[model samples]
Target: MKKNGEMAVRRPDDMHLHVRQGELMKVVVPQTAAVFKRAIIMPNILPPVTSAERLERYRERVVAAAGSASGFEPLMTFKIIPGLSPDVVQELKQAGALAGKLYPEGATTNSEDGVSDVQTIYPVLEEMQRNDIVLSIHGEDPDVFSLDREEAFLPTLRQFSRDFPDLRIVLEHLSSAAAVQAVAELPNVWGTITLHHLELTLDDLLGGELQPHYFCKPIVKRPSDRAAIQRAALSGSPKYFFGSDSAPHPVDRKHAPTARAGIFSAPVAYQGLLRFFGEHDALERIEGFTAVYGADFYGVPKNGDELVVRRQDWTAPDEVGGLVPYHAGEVFPYTVIPGWK
Candidate 1:
């Protein structure tokens, strides 16, 4: 439904996003739902969406939020906790929840309720394997490697794949060379790279200019590590896909003395990628990263909806709906011209 010759492209899915809950959800959900046909919603809510009943309620709320927006009907996928029993996994799968999300405790915001030990949830893993359910991992061991958790976590996750060959595992927002290599080598393992990590490096963190917005769990790595991630994302491997991991925090929270870490890139994610691709002369390969690869990796159907990325210039809001805003006052080179039916 886009204008002719406008560089329209199929709608993209956000494999990872945190739309928060309640008031914050009301403000931010529309921006993402407008662009992405579906998203793997994060489970790190205030109380944590750990039970089937809570997940159902959360899904209802998300649906209600979407209902208020015309032409926007984004699918909400529930992220399961690792503590659920095997029976619970079967029940949720039968009822059509998308997949499970495993957050190692203390890994990031609101993740205190996440699984403290992976071994403690073996029963749930068994059920997920039996039910053909996908398990999305945060990919860090809370205790062992503070700054280098990805290096410490990949081996355990690789072992899990070996133990449960049938279970689909997605390593979310992978920021290390080891993670990229593990996903490439493992048959059932898939990995997602976020736009923030794809573009920045540790020096950015150390310099403290971008600071909070650039900070995130399994924190950004050295420049060489980022180069490895960039290579893997452009590698055209089916298992390497895109996930914005577009977490938004209020401007006040972001600019505070103890600012929260997250980047709200949903509104401009594709444009950012397109610019990167265009500069790299990989514009033609954008489809692999934006649409095809993620669907194939997750076994979800490609979205029938389409959008356009025009060459028009636009500035991202300093604040949208009273949220602090992502890249708060920066300008970008492209815009996502949406035309959802």
Candidate 2:
């Protein structure tokens, strides 16, 4: 329990979460399920989930993992491809997909199946727009604009918005100031801020000693960019919300000779956010960023379920399921008090 007046709000959804398949899924799903009432599961997996059929199978696996965990049915999304017909979109909507994900080719982990040509996907995008479907984008260029991918991709995304004004678009994990500004200026664009990106920068991760933990795609930028994102997240704007982007890779992969790309914060997500907010003296806005904004933007009903974060501290397990490492170490100052048994 908290020392005095301290209390936790309800558990929040992870707008972005990656639970890999088979064994890894079995190992990781429970950790996230214990905290988040629902999560928008990423489709980038081995043989990425691009079809309705595959999405169902994945959903089944997730449901099975939820088992007796009440209020823990994590929602899944289809990473739609150009090859998928409009009818397919309608079919998946009928199947209960919360949204669809769009990844530009080779942008991040397991993204080879992503769209190679955005133009080719226009028909599918149009279909989604008509159906009131949301398109969650990876938001980066495939090549050339490496360092400035977010800026480079804006023109294309702007055109997409113009072509499909009604489509609900979410730009996943906005890293740079330019990205945040673009999302802020665009009417249809909602943006997510990842926990890792919220905390560190590219130079902090790679420049001095190669701190692999700070490495993430659309890689972190200058301090000025960080400041901008901090402002946007705290601004209480409905268009911006919290997404841990809690991707997990085996400790071997993260600490390897060639470290892999991802961060696993599922275990300590809420506490970390609380610490970050409290340090900034922005605790009151925590609910806006973590729960209200995300639920409102996604059209998900507010989960009446409440969770408390006691002042008592806890540390994330160094290794969960004997693979993925907890982001940083387990030095959190809060614990989620779940509503359900």
Candidate 3:
């Protein structure tokens, strides 16, 4: 993959990404489109994309924002709410939804309407299993302490694997070693590792200063957790793959008294990942981690085109599309060669 100071790999598919609705979406969608050929769009926007009509409309808006030339595919998902009709699952599949996101109530931003009890959505999960629709969960138990939430939710995850044995579940943005091991042990279950989680720790978020932007739901964990996640990603296991979780919030909202939980990583993700994989001597395996495994798991075709990165220094943008990006102002040794397919 690497030769003559350049690396080439399949254009990645971001398995988990959040491009919010309306004006904000317009600003961020293209950043992801630039580096990723497709992205699984999150559905937890205000009012949420719960119905078929809403999902179609949201997909349309995302496509429009991505524009005709980006060749970006927004793999849409619907929000999973309690009491959801099983019949509605068929409609969502017909509506082109590839998955359903389960956000525990009050777990993250705009998730106040999420499912509180895991069992309450069993009917919906049953339908999805029969229909082969993927179940993407936020994977945090809201009642627990911030650091313990992900660990606390493992029991529920285990129960789901036992109850709905055939369901394809994605435990999103894993932050701990325990979670990494749990996902590895479960069959038909996969985990998405965020760039922030791979590169950061609780220390990066709070051990220095109040880094509100680094603050995220299932907040980044200890150094050992980061190591475990890094090990998993580098281990070449098909069960773990890349998902930027590139959430963008307005500057004011991120800097406010109650700062939001997200990191706008789309702009920096690919380049940072190139450096990380290369430095770790795992450059050859990056293609599968970013572009192959997730698509294969979803039963989609891998991207035929390639994305190139040059061994060139570039500074990470301080602010992108009015939102702060991950590793802002840091100089990266590798940079994506823009507009080169």
Candidate No. with top lDDT:
3
Residue 81 C-alpha lDDT in model 2: 61
On the 0 to 100 scale, the lDDT of residue 244 in model 3 is 94
Worst 10 residues of 3 by lDDT: 1-10
Model 3: per-residue Cα lDDT over 1-341, one tens digit each: 55688877799999999999888998999999988999999998888898999999999999999998889999999999877788899999999999999999999999888899787889999999999999999999989898899999999999999999999999999999999999999997899999999999898899989999899988999899999999999999999999999998999999999888899999999888888998998888899899999999888999987877888898998888778888899999888888646
- The top-ranked prediction according to TM-score is 3
Model 1, 291: alpha-carbon shift in Å? 1.7
Give lDDT tens digits, candidate 1, residues 1-341: 13542566778777888888888888888877777777777767867665677777787777777555534443334445555666767667655666778877777787767787678888888888887778888888878765678888877898899989989998999898888889889999999988878888887876666577777777888888788889888877778888988888877887788978788887667777877776776766777887888877667788787777776676777777877554666666667775564
Q: What C-alpha lDDT does candidate 1 achieve relative to the native structure?
A: 0.76
CA shift of 42, model 1, Å:
1.4
1 or 3, greater by TM-score: 3
TM-score per candidate, chains pooled: 0.92, 0.94, 0.98
How does candidate 2 fare on TM-score? 0.94
A best-first ranking of the candidates according to their lDDT comes to 3, 2, 1
- Compared with the true structure, what per-residue lDDT tens digits does model 2 show for residues 1-341? 24584575866788998888888788778878887888888888877776788889998898787666555767778886657676788888877777889888888887877788888888888888887888898888868566788777888878877888788899999988888988888888899998777888778887799876677787888888888888888887888999888887877788788887787777777778888887787887888888788888888887777777677677767677776554546677766665542
The per-residue C-alpha lDDT of model 1 at residue 82 equals 52
TM-score of the candidate numbered 1? 0.92
After superposition, candidate 3 runs with Cα above 4 Å error: 1-3
The CA lDDT of each predicted structure is 0.76, 0.80, 0.91
Runs of candidate 2 with Cα error greater than 4 angstroms are 1-5, 324-326, 338-341
